[model samples]
Target: MAGDSVRDDELAWLDATEQAELVRGGELTPSELAEAAIERIERTNGALNAVVTPLFEKAVAQAASAQLPAGPFRGVPMLLKDMVCHSAGDPLHGGMRVLRDHGWTEPEDSHLAARFRAAGFVFCGKTNMPELATSVTTEPLAHGATRNPWDPSRSPGGSSGGSAAAVAAGMTPVAHGNDMAGSIRVPASCCGLVGLKPTRARTSLGPGHGEYWGPVAHEHVLTRSVRDSAAVLDTIRGMAPGDPYTAPPPSRPYREEIGLDPGALRVGLRTAVPGAAGQPHQDCVAAVDEAARLLESLGHHVEPSAAAVLDSPAILEGFSAVFGTIVAWEVDRWSQRIGRRIDLGELEPMNARTAEVGRSAPATQWLSGLHTWQQWAREAAALWEQELDVLVTPTLATPPWQLGELAPTALAPAELAAAVGEKIAFTVPFNITGQPAISLPLHRNPDGLPIGVQFVAAYGREDVLIRLAAQLEQAAPWSMARPPVSA
Candidate 1:
């Protein structure tokens, strides 16, 4: 087979779908593709700090080996976020300084990792993230902050910031990223990519734990194309044997939904997060306005909305008990596995105190908070069934903030909840509701920072999102909007 002579600069611009097709068509060998990615990572990672643990040798060996699986993404390179994603026998620091200090490695592959391998993905490296994934900005003390490819001085939304950066900069076309609250979509917004927080139980987070934050957290990917997101989701979405919950199965593979007509759908436009946290920045508000116009242009009905569930202080109170306690649990579990006690001093101040507050909170309060979030989820989901088919809002209240500005370490757990919750205001409510939400990079501020517009669908309805996202993506393409500090 004759391979196409893909130049390094030209190769950097292709999305995963294009890259995989080129490989399949004998225009790019898997080995050549892998080497190009490694070289790109080496060239760009120093400035981006996106890939913390380079698996260059491993990726090269796997790429050249004949023992590769015949999966859809075969020959395409990817990165895993430094969190629940694990590759057996590889360093797996989840952006935690304590684990990094100990040189911890995962003993086995997470189910997701196994599926990724099965899909013909070459594991390139692990990306940087915030400490304990507690912050939206990826300024991890362990690996340092992952700078936005859009603007190095600004933050890439975290804790998947590293993955987003790498993907944005063309170091990798797609990367693994999980959402506890807004980890996936926030960074997608900041980095100008497609980030989908799948429905609760849509994908497995197995062997480690069944649920997180009373089931708000989810695992997914960050990619430049809607079709890439859909294809990856098709490859990875399923119920593992021991999963506690199972999202209703899609009628067919989600990839098929990419170009499908979404019909005349009712869309709710929420420009600002309601309540004391205040309006989204003017850029963010304008993004919503712009997205509404775009959706209407596409023949969808758009109407004004106020996210009532997020407006209440109850969200912070209810979120605190579950978030704090689960964090404490994960830390203790990891400590036991490593056979070492976590010195409070070793953890970032906010995370250390977060665990402390979690430990002190009553078990009853944790249970109560779980119930509250579920209720909030129901109320939020009701909008779709009653008045709208999708809800659109600014992914973050504002565009990317400068590094170190949002990680307020001095605050108490409740105070931190108010602060952190406000930053992820639009995305978290859907996490609470177990609905599928997506952040589309549809608009850019005057400063050229991307302002992602979020569209949330009812529980287990990512097909609707994929169809709508594909339409929106075609309306306003962002693939050519590469950051200045790119591969």
Candidate 2:
């Protein structure tokens, strides 16, 4: 098929699976797909500022190369978030001005990047992210801000905001994203995509470090379809050599889980922000209510319930302790790698303050914080063990807010923490428990912005999530819901 026959919007909306099928069937060469994506990025990225580093020439060459792997997603174009998962010879700034100023490029591909390449994804570019992936918004000093495609005034959510924005705006069918404190899911929620944070260690963090930000961080992708997410996971999910730990391997390929019936499930619904004084926005609450009803109609047992331990304020204290220390360690690690100390002034104010807190925290306090989290996780797991198969909540407390509203530069440390706490209230608990969670775009507010609902499964139970998410996807299809600023 000739490229001129297909509308650019049609090609932009095709998921990776569909794009791969066309390439495999010889209807379109990989070069056509790559070039089409590049054109879309060139046309759309200026408004969204999603792709920070375009590799169009390299992508076109790779797509046309005979060496391109013939894996499931062969010939598909995708964007990598410029954090955690690095691509060889590509600029890996981690959204920091210091790294960009130093002109640092990753010498080798991360294990995850290799898996993506093996699966036949052409890396068109790296997406923008918050500095050091510290803030929940993608307004890094290095890359400016990535505007939401849904509404330019609002945020796309971060540190995976650029990835989410790119996918939503149709620059790419899918993009890599990592979640520490709702980075992937929040962005997915904001951008109207599927964002899955697989169980801890499901995807390796290797040849560099074992775990990122303790056990709370996990890497995956934001895609327009549940099956795309499942297919991508099947390709990248595994342990690397000398890894710290690994999630339980799926009984079969995760792709097989799609369309499989998720028999009658006992789902608990929660709309209140745990440990916070107020409930989420009315729109968010309504989203959960609608999702619960939809689940009930689909033969799942949905009830108004939540784990009691979620209300404990102590959870925040423990999370803060671990989070702060990790930031400090990250600063130190980068300093050693760059062969110079990273002055506090070089970091964003929020991270600089967090580093200070982390540096001052005694080892005993850090350990105590870990112990506290472990204790709470054990307690929280009881809800699943006794009654719930899945827990549903609003992915974020509200729909996407204005871009600068949550900027660390505009708020004091405590103010920023409180604001971030509200946004991540429902998503972070599962991160601590090392369970699988996914954000689905099930609702949209009056303003036409997406409001996502999160579903949590027991530890290492991504199969459960995939099945249910697929079922929900079918029940309320969202693939055709395009944003205002899109390809």
Candidate 3:
């Protein structure tokens, strides 16, 4: 094994798997890798503002200690989204000025945070997010907008935009993100990275709670390589004792599924979402058309299919009801946890209106909304069971927008909600049904910004998605691509 140290400049683009291999092969020490990452963070964070809180000294101390575990991602540097993935005593501001001002801190590691540590990831810092992670763009009054590395004038998609931009810019190989609406895949689409939202309960959300935002959320990572994503899933996928949900066990490790051919499959392709948000840009639809052709070449039967539920007023209304009520509950929960009232000054108008709608709505209304979505879930999942082995679509209605195009701070409540709904139409439906979905950067626009192709599998069918993603990645590789402001 070579004992030579790799230069920091040379380390910028290596993914987590490659970095870990270098450490195990004696080419680099954990301390050296951590320092290189810190230097990269210092070098580029000023440009992107992706990282909200730097824990460089703490990461260095941990990496240099003898107590570091020997796990799959040994020595790999990581950043956590400043939401529920909290570490004891760490500042987990959730991109809210109130929390940052009052010095809110997590008492201990949430279950997922502990899992990241057990996987041998060294946490360097917390990434920026929208206020309460409610916005689809990462601009918050607490911390200014986290700019896209491809074009700083545009967004990196949110609320996981910070993690997506940091990983795409080479500040870290992998960073934590969770999908409630389209948080994970939206940012992945905008930032030119791979993001997978595992089947609900495929990962434990505990030491915090059984689930977040009901079943509309799942925790995972954003990565440059499909293999890295698969490997990370292998390392952290498990059920906690008290978890409210449990995914069916995989036949084998997710990493083992990579490179293995996913036999001829049935693929349903849809280019535009229905309803008010139905006007998809030509560039976005073009990306999906490109993916359909590529899949056809790979021998998968690709056919046009629409998710009819997405067009239903009942479904849309139910989505808004569930979303509003959940937001209200969370606002009350977080504020009460700190023994304070919901400060309007600290909350964005869009989110404040959501909470008000929830609080003011009759109890029957909230129950009816929950019941409506349950029915919608069954109807949506039936499309997959009766027909599709996989569904392919453009990840967004448009490419990453200019930074203020959907500003949470300036828009009226209804307008803001509609704006978010428009951008996230396709991705949100999968979240509603607890299915596994992944965003792969398959094409670039005429001006050279990335556009993602999203593949969604039936519930608990991540194995199918991972296998297909690996296959697509190999057939039309995007690994060599880099953003202009990358490390």
Q: lDDT for model 1, on a 0 to 1 scale?
A: 0.86
* Candidates 2 and 3, the one with greater TM-score: 2
Candidate ranking under lDDT, highest first, comes to 2, 3, 1
Which runs in model 3 stand beyond 4 Å of their true positions?
1-5, 277-279
lDDT scores of the candidates, listed in order: 0.86, 0.91, 0.88
Question: TM-score of predicted model 1?
Answer: 0.97
Name the lDDT value of residue 271 in candidate 2.
84
In candidate 3, position 290 carries an lDDT of: 94
Residue by residue across 123-153, what tens digits does model 2's lDDT show?
A: 9999999988887889988889999999999
- lDDT over C-alpha atoms for residue 467 of model 2: 99
Prediction 3 global C-alpha lDDT: 0.88
For 242-318, candidate 1 gives per-residue lDDT tens digits of 88878999999999998899999988887767555567899998998998888999999888876565586667767
> In model 3, what lDDT does residue 356 have?
80
> For model 1, how big is the CA root-mean-square deviation?
1.8
Q: All candidates: CA RMSD in angstroms?
A: 1.8, 1.2, 1.7
Off by over 4 Å in 1: 1-4, 407-417
Report backbone clashes per prediction: 1, 0, 0
